[model samples]
Target: MNDKSQLVFCIGHCRIDPTDNSITFQMQGCSPFANETTKVSLQPKFIEVLSYLALRHPNVVTRNELVEQVWEGNVYVGTKALTNAIWHLRQHLLPLAHSGPVIETVRKTGYRLLLEPEYEQLNVLEDNLKIIEAKLDTANRHMQFILLFMSALVVITGVIVGVHLYQDNLRMIDTQIKVITQDPGSERYPRLSHNRRWLVYGASQPSGNKSLFLKDLQGDDLPVRQLTSLNSSELRAVWSADDSKLYFASHYLDTDECAITQLDLATNEIHSLAPCSSEMGAIDISSDGNYLSYISKHESDKNGGIYRLSLNTQNAKAERLSCELTCNYEDRDLAYSPDGKLLAIARRFSNISEDIIIRNLNTGEEHRLTEGLEDIRGLTWAPDGQRIVYATENSGSRNGFIIDIKSAQFRSLDIDGMSYPNSVSDKGELVYHQYRRQFEMAYYSLGGNVPSSLFPLLYSGGGHRNPDYSTQAARLVFVSSDSGYSEIWISDIHGEKLEQLTYLKSRVAYPRWSPDGLKIAFIAPDDSHEGNRIYILDLVNKNIFALASGYHNHGRPTWNWQGTSILASTSDGITEFYLDNKSPKVINALKMGVGFAKSSTEIVFSRYDVKGLWLIDLNYPNRIEPFISDQIFNAGNNWVLTKGGVYFKSKNSTEQILNYWDASTQQVTPILKLPRSSISGFGSLAYEPNSKRLVMTLDGFPQRDIMLLKHKLLQ
Candidate 1:
């Protein structure tokens, strides 16, 4: 629209890169050469789009090219995805974008990185090329050093030193992983009430199952009790004044009014008040249960808006308030004032954005409550009914502000970041889960004086990860979320230093810390090649060499006890990613294939079920041997090489039982029961051999949680 410098439109700004995960840039201090100060933190997809544009900066990337990079060529990131991200970005950063678009459009052809760059130094084009050249030199030198060192260690050191180095390398690769998160436990926020009588939160446990749990709001971290048994999807829930009925939204095919459902806790009966298949999300009801308001995503309306249903006369009028079109205005904030006489609505109409609009039902006239403040948050009328306070995420920080209804005055207050409550009681005290904090480790404290605080400390909201202790010497590595993208990251165990690994938009999966610990292997779907491939990252060097690309349908790669190579399972797969080569090389031609890699050398990997062990060796060529296949599925995981045999999960029929396989006698023994199939984040079952502990990753759907399931490992 506004053709200032070049309009750099980031479509899916929140996508993680595949090549190296760390380089994501969504909303930040500023895009190079721009004065924009505002940025959107609400959506991750938008961030991915920004990352893509930043990577290809100073280049004129066409819309189609933008789509491929941002969406990983997926249909989900369609027109809406593109436009929404672009629009939101403009809302936040266009002011800066006015100087010059880090992006520009080409009449035709895909997109090219605009030559313009504002690095405080080199021009944009020079910066891109310089980065590529530096990495190239680093790769060449690293390969030469590794080959020379490995050649000697092959027999004398026997891959002992090389493998250990490689194992540490895997740890370093995690720093580059992208950040992909959602409701984490469930689609709703944790709801806490003052009486401390109940600590409520939504959890989608047992995988694909959503339910609510209530726990003692007190001292002891007591066990949680299940409340609602709706196996389907249960939306946000709010407590009624009497606490007699829990009103929420549950949508299923049976209910025509898929919109509203009043769960009467007294009778445990689910009542459907309004019948409309409109998809419903955020809901806020009047304390007395007299009036209700919620945002509905419907097929007919196409563009989602605010809707209301009343309990009086069964609230029969049950109307759709198309203020966006009918009243020549758009409504976002839809909350009822305490007395219910004034509806405190956050309204925005295209050019004119977010302003609180108060509609007097008795007067049938609407008045602008808070204008010129594009900064309104989840608004709730104060208990006394005079003041309306809401959480506002303005500029780059999140805070709470209050507005007076009668006097039309506004005041701002600083509160803890947990202010993301969609529905709050009239009570000044709020109820919501505190936002997770993320740390950005910075070196050489700004001043040699004070305790060097970690830079970019999670002041507002961010997901957290367990800091890997003792790994400082080893290397702190893990998959992480950066600016809404998922990528591998490698850092000092202290998390004082971090480096990102993946650069492509495709998501990286199952980063394995090699036994030798020099290299890490993971799966990345390369839509460009139209197939999944294994990517091996060299930690010390930051060189990414595709072990295998589209040609191999292989996945879940694990490093062998010897770090020089890796072991992977697949079907009709190809060998190491072939780039310069014109022809394809098949590593296997069978149904379930197994393969191994010895540096540049590789052979098929297979599981000998008859002998009951994994049997793939790089030196064996087509031959497969019996390793240690038990009754359980050890062949699948990065089978742990521990003092207490190999631990793995075996899915017999209904249950995925945890079991251990003895290396000596080759005996299989069951350990403990598990929650579901596969570990969280698809991470391998980490065997703490020193402690003989069997640890499994607990699943945190929407977003994975760092959970440790400890058990005794049979020696």
Candidate 2:
């Protein structure tokens, strides 16, 4: 075969003659030269490389020649790209060529096709091409006339179809609601099998460990079977297309690494597919059962992105799919469309904002479906692929919404509690997890009075967090989600005359009163920008301005005793912002939660990597030592400092208790035994000196269960 003869057909296939038989290589669609019988697919770049090599059969192609032909003389294309393409091409070709290797590699040179492919006659191919071209031209003329008539018919049909769809949309979708699992332990990440006979989910035990369980949905008793016995945490169980195997990701407790595994449902056999770091996100299988898509950072990549792997190939490496050079984002919650043409993903740009992006698998083009949504926990595509249902936090509460992709219009689904959409069946049945959490702000008086709820009469449905008192103004400041978003609110010490301070409509946290009670400082996410910034609200003029700081990940802003400077915590370390200076000064090289003692000579903070409290003296910032050791302290909002010592909370085997650490005696003693509850670091703990009162947010027992929603659309 010669290159001149191969030029007869530019975009078709060729039959290569082996020693025993001939093999066909087809290149007509987006995916070129994929083996038809073996069902092995290759990337477009790899196909181009194979075609370039096959055209010049029996001739060695240099690396430079392959790169120039495949990449079209693109100078920026690195050698790694060509090496990867050739490697994949070799893998795809190895199965078809069973006699020996089809692609022969020359050391320090390029690759070549060993088989001599016979070229079809140029005149015959040209004549066949002309006949096909003439038929296509005739078909185009007929299509023009048919399109004109169809255009008129479509105008009338569209109105009728539009009316019918509007009526369908207006029809009630809610039908029967049933609680599937009511175990006291938390159940989440529900997935239904393709056959609709089994339900699988992850449930948390009393020891805070998770395992996977399978429920027989069609059985009379609806019994649940424990599928996995590993001590590690298992999440997001998805079934195989034939319902004979279950795939899930497991996080090892000891090493904190994650791995995807496949479990044969019948024989209970398990196999590991791939291992990733702790930052791995969601996983999904392709509709054809040939590829598995997931998001993770491989051992070689600097950041995590979407990747695809071939299930049939042994030890197949994941191919990166997401392009991050233009906009850096972390992807999660991958859901493949019903037709497998698009992939929907949740992309996180910052701590507070995330967007849903739809990516074309063939073209690598992305279209963002939702923008500026806060904290998207999970999302899934509808069975028809026309709408997307996602769970997000609205006004500090979790809710689900359905959005039309083309119109960008959304409507809320009326399910209660913190709901997360897990899976939607083809019949429109939905499986989700609903969570209910309750927390009350209790006031503890050190002067022998019992604790009570701060505002019993004005208690709202949403959560109230981070309460602080101002003795000078006889008022208290707190963050509340009662206004549909977390906002700063103020009330009198007696729980009267409540008023809202800031209205940024974003998530606000850790509100603290100034020493002189003239201003309030808090942490609020900058919606227009990135990261959480500290802002001060003037009580007299009602003015809010961001503090002068170069860093963005700042929180827990507390004023000094003299009210001349503020202390805040950042990801890098703790910083001090003076009222007179325009820039913040780095106080200490420690990443921890920080607060000043009553005397202002030292600061008490908690180390995240360690288990105890530490103190840094202002007179000697470099001298930081453990203030209290051998105590398991919660990371945030679990401790406060007074003039004498620190009042902190700790959990024992029985319950959580409040303890007092005396500075002079260097001893610790339990002050109060709190109720059995889970303490979230994001909640607040405050202490008042004048009234000797302690206040903290306690999360009551969480009610988590799996719920099933049946609708008319599912039928």
Best by TM-score: 2
TM-score of 2: 0.69
- Per-residue lDDT of model 1, residues 187-246, tens digit only: 334444435366555556545555666656464456666666654556356666666666
What's the residue-level lDDT of 218 in candidate 1? Answer: 60
User: What shift in Å separates residue 566 of candidate 2 from its native position after superposition?
Assistant: 4.2
Query: TM-score of model 1 relative to the true fold?
Result: 0.36
State each candidate's clash count.
84, 3
Candidate 2 lDDT by residue in tens digits, 1-715: 1122223222223333322222345543213244433232334565566666766676899888877776655322324457646654554455446677778888899888876543445576457668879999999999999999999999999999999999988774766778889887788878788777788888876666678999988883866898877567885677787888887777777777778788998999988888765322577877777778877765553456777878889998878787644434667678887788888888865445567889888998888776557677677788888888888875557777787777766777766663657568765688888877765566666756565423232366767767887778777788878877778888875456989876666677788888788999887655333456677877875656567776646757878777777887664477888776578887887865657555567777776646777778877888988777745455345787776888888875456777787889988887777545655455666777876777777575677788888766443
